[model samples]
Target chain A: MGVRVQEGDFDLAVELADFGRGAGGIVTFTGVARNNDAGNLQYMEIEHYPAMTQSAIEAIANEARSRWDLCDLLIIHRHGRLAPGARIMMVATASAHRADAFAAAEFLMDYLKSRAPFWKKEVTSDSAEWVAAKEADEKALDRW
Target chain B: MIDVVYFAWVRERIGLPRESVETDATTVAELIDELSKREERYALAFSDRGAIRAAVDQTLVDLDAPLKGAREVAFFPPMTGG
Candidate 1:
């Protein structure tokens, strides 16, 4: 379980340089900050419960590894102010088969999106609002 | 005294991120009731309890959940993480 909650940017190349040695398949997902349809976004600020963030990610990663025969998993989520096109976070999973890797990656993504104790607030020149939890996101968990 | 904390608009409405709360409330819901009676902002923040989520000692819990010797309590809206 390699879960990092940081304010600094991470190097994808360096992170995956030796991600999974024996695993035949590897899947990755990256989320980047973007603008809303109404305005030009200045930045996004992510706030997370410091005490629970790490343990929550570790629990999710552990659950994914248990259900799938995953070799390794990595989760990195960034906080503080981030500009548009800046990376918000990334998730990677590795397994012996493509299906396991893909499934585990999606599982981690869904759980992180809905259950993690992090919140996002989008700031524009005119207004700022906390990003609300989408109904679809909560429904996405039904598949798991 | 429990260290109560708020996040996002919950904090904005209450105008504080954290505070030392003196209380005899045995459950999270009771704590909310106590706080809401103290100020209008707390009432506004806890008005829509369905939209709020509680955490005791950093673990997510329901409002009906017991305090259970908790050192910290957090209240926030449903998460929007990725």
Candidate 2:
């Protein structure tokens, strides 16, 4: 289990088939592209620094492994155009106990939300806007 | 020559993705100040320093981060990834 950044969609079942072979508990989280409140969304365009994406994710994974007793961890994030309901990314963590898995998963999510270089721009029928980073997201990092 | 890059709306406003600049600025802030004086586009894109984030050689850093030995620097909006 490692990190992957690509434009192709991933299969969750296929991804987990051989994941965390010896772990007692595995926790997984998937983020989906959501429709806007107005419900007139077309797609989301995700942009990332190609040279930094992989290493940045690897650093986050290493931090998670350092802070938890993990067996395996996987992070798969997609870039390019994604429509509503399409999966944007996934994080999976395996540990001897469920608590560690859950905590590490959350930690990874919190860090990725702000530290990663990816940006999302939502496109509607007639307008496009970059999604602003929430104040809550930066604050979420303080708890860990 | 310092390789400077931009992403998302920063790139859109700057009208390009990356460039190399020869400069003697000692900090990221000074570098931004240098670029900001180059054109109205640079000034507009960097108008709000609080809304912009800087990275030195692919590692995120403060605006005051030194540029003495930096080869690459990137400026972009706050990340909204998950």
On DockQ, the leading prediction is 2
Give the clashing pairs for model 1. none
Candidate 2 residue A59 C-alpha distance from true site, Å: 0.5
- Residue-level lDDT tens digits of model 1 in A9-91: 98899999999779999999999998777759999999988888898888888899889998988999999999999999999
Residue-level lDDT tens digits of model 2 in A14-58: 999999999999999999999999998899999999989898999
What value does the lDDT take at residue A53 in candidate 1? Answer: 86
Output the lDDT of residue B75, model 1: 96
Please give, as one word, the docking class of candidate 1.
high
Residue A141 C-alpha lDDT in model 2: 95
> Positional deviation of B4 in candidate 1, in angstroms?
0.5
Which segments of candidate 1 are over 4 A away from where they belong? none
lDDT of 2 by residue, B1-82 (tens): 9999999899999999999999989999999999999999999999999999988988999999999889999999999999
Q: For chain B alone, what TM-score does every candidate structure achieve against the true structure?
A: 0.98, 0.98
Question: Which DockQ values do the candidates obtain, in the order shown?
Answer: 0.88, 0.91
Q: Any residue pairs clashing in model 2, and if so which?
A: none
